[model samples]
Target: MTRFARTVAAVALTTALALTAGCGGSDSDADAGSDGKALKKVTYLTSFGNFGRDAYAWVAKDKGFFKDAGFDVTIRPGQGTGGVIPAIVGGQAQFGPIDLTGGLLNMGNGQAKDFVAVAAVQQHTMAAIATTEGNGISKPKDLEGKRLADTPGSVVRNLFPTYARLAGVDATKVKWVNGEAQTLMGTLAGGSVDGIGQFVVGKPTVEAVTKKKAVLLPYSAVIPDLYGNVLITSKKNAENDPESVRRFTAALLKGLEYSLGHTQEAAQILKRNVDTTNPAAAAAELELMAGYVTPKDGSGAVIGSLDSGRVAKSIRLLEDAGTLPKGMTPDQIIDFDLVPKG
Candidate 1:
């Protein structure tokens, strides 16, 4: 999913596809500001099709945070960060939900304009390998000498082999098979492939539908701590339209807090927003996402909290591992100016 998260299609404006109706508070909650004016509208583009961000959107609308913040917010789902950055830069949308790394890579390659992470939606990585039961694949190393399906350039497909290497498996031994998300689950259930990287949220759903237990290998358990989905916007947008971004971020974080606090209700809302074949599965996945939603208590709950030191560490790791180009600084990969210190 992270690979799909990374290689998502380029951002563009389209007919406003309202997945669920937006919820707002009463007139009192929408009380006028100093000038007694209404809120401004901010359009946001999401980075993936089944990304499951409806939780945040719904919570915000139902909670009146956006109305209080003076924003008429509209959310559009993008296939990947590729599509998101362009849309924001083109002013087709105000900001977008994107992978922080993918957004930075786009900026570094000059494929997109500079942007800031207004808030971190899911700090921990969520992609993982879900395997069929009775395959005797108990651990990460068991994936060796098996077929794994994935699209090329997917974060999971591209990184799994490396992750296997770290887990003491000869990544070359595993056969790479090309397949789509639908086919991957089918293949795994049908015994065509041993396993494939999938979102952990989808694992339980797959098990319920396929009647098979899947072992989800959390990447955080194997590799360096990495940031996942985030609220992103152009540097110009952030600097010139700070109020809009602030309103958007506040509403989004409020949504996150609500979703985290109320999973069962949130899951019901999520099932309605996601692909419909697996409502129970979607509900289960939304529950799984709570891990990504709320950071540990010791860890502050800054929506877009960033650590320059950690980023520098990742740069060194990627450079050493040949994943990132040399001489890339954290500043080149991150724009912390937009995210205020909590």
Candidate 2:
């Protein structure tokens, strides 16, 4: 197995053991709901830290959406998108918010056959080429011949070729400088590298470090069909407890819609559960992310629903980028039936 695969396997094994130990008792031992009945215990794993990226899940828990759905949900922080699939497959988490590309690539590579996305949270690629204001890297083409801080396992770096193809640029000309996420923005600001392939969501991190606004060249600007975070589960979960999955999806979508309409309130709610050291920064990030939850294609405002056409396009893009095999189709990676309808 590759290093990434090995790391995921290790993390999944640890997570599964920890989770099993946490729920050693019977179902009746689970936390009681508002009705005094034992709520079904379920665990959720996120792709990253609680940096307002998972505001919806936080909001849902704080607002009692999961409780209303008869589930006592335990949210756990994940290592990354690469680890989330393994967490779910190994029965550590019943549901996970993961990167759609990573999930699809795993399916295409035959690493994960039972994993499928029930809901797409972000409608576009959150990855971008972030640079300082005066870096002279205004567009994708400008990245050619420039030194870019390439963080290990970054989705942006993995999909840089697809972005380059869409923007009509030669990705080979760009000089990649290996770095870590903690130091990428600092390195770029200190002139060690021209830019960094990062997520637009990290704008706050960059601004906090450099005390200057970061210029983001979003991958979605070039590849409009790309997707970001998604709600994924194993086929076994869907088959065994369809109602639980439905309730979870409905509650999550409700939380997403609530967050979109009440950004400040959502941030406050998120503060109660997650780390919001800078409330203003968290609120700002949530506001920017709200647009991602809104569908750009005039589809209904319901969150967590997949756009089949967009998924089809994304499949083709992944295939062309060599992430997915040529014969892989959307049906293998996505399960639209689990998304609750109005």
lDDT of 2 by residue, 150-247 (tens): 64445667677777887989989988777653346557768888888666766775676667777888888888777887898888998888877888
Worst lDDT run of 10 residues, candidate 1, spans 4-13
List model 1 lDDT by residue over 70-188, tens digit each. Answer: 76666555545666667777888876676665555555556666666777767666656777677767788888777887644345665564467667878888888876433456666
In model 1, the runs with Cα more than 4 Å from the true position are 1-39, 50-54, 81-92, 104-113, 150-153, 171-193, 271-283, 300-303
lDDT of each: 0.60, 0.68
TM-score of candidate 2 versus the correct structure, residues matched by position: 0.82
Best by TM-score: 2
Error of 1 at 334 (Å): 2.8
List TM-scores for all candidates, in order: 0.77, 0.82
